[model samples]
Target: MNSKEFLNELKKYSNDLLVSMSFDQIFKEELLKLYPRKIINCHAGKLPFYRDRNILNWALINNEKEFGISVHFIDKGINTGDIILQKTYEIKDSDDYTTLLNLCHKECASLLYESLILFLEDNVKAYKQKRKKKGGGNI
Candidate 1:
């Protein structure tokens, strides 16, 4: 389903969950204020340095040493959120875009599933992020 369809369905269940539907930046700011818990998002690539699109393409082009997925809180800027979890897989020198993408997709799926499990069991605190830091560091 498209974003509009998905959002419409989400709105139908608003009573069971918080719902805010607006493209305006102020709406997002308002959400940040009203929501008590963290706001999460799944980034397709390792964040900070790899902030642009088509990360798989970029990773292959640049011949990266590693690639990964990150689950992070959504802040004001792009991919600047506090990282809740990250999982990386080494990039083989001979690896191409397709292979690297498969690895990234696998990690993303695992992390997403794990995050949902934690949310349901109320053990999300197990992966609580450390203090937010600037850009990419050792990981």
Candidate 2:
């Protein structure tokens, strides 16, 4: 089903939180309004930097020394949400695209677990991204 239809169905359920991992479709403003800070997303790249698709490829292409996994509250803009947790992995000389991708997936899983714990405990203090700055250090 389409995103709108899916959302309409979702509204039938009573959920306190929404977790999205590698979900391709963008949540519309109406959905965001309905959910507010209830939605969270796990991304394979640092926010306000590698915002969208193929982040692993982009990091490799850019010759980055490290890459990160971020969990944040979902907002309207692409990955422009308040960050909840972030973790970085070093890029080794021997690492190829596949290797790096694998690493990202592994680290992402761990980060997600940790972020969820923090959220459940109400220990997570999310920070807003500075739109003026394009990039920053790894977490």
Best by TM-score: 2
Per-residue lDDT for 28-66 in model 1, tens only?
554554443455666767766575567777777777888
lDDT of 2 by residue, 1-139 (tens): 2377887898899987888889987778988988889888889987767887988888888899988888999988878899988887898889989998887778878888888888788888999976655345332
lDDT of 1 at 60: 71
Best by the lDDT measure = 2
lDDT of 1: 0.60
Q: Per-prediction TM-score, please?
A: 0.65, 0.87
Clashes of each: 0, 0
With candidate 2 superimposed using the best TM-score fit, by how many Å does residue 123's alpha carbon deviate from the native? 1.9
Residue 97, model 2: lDDT of 90
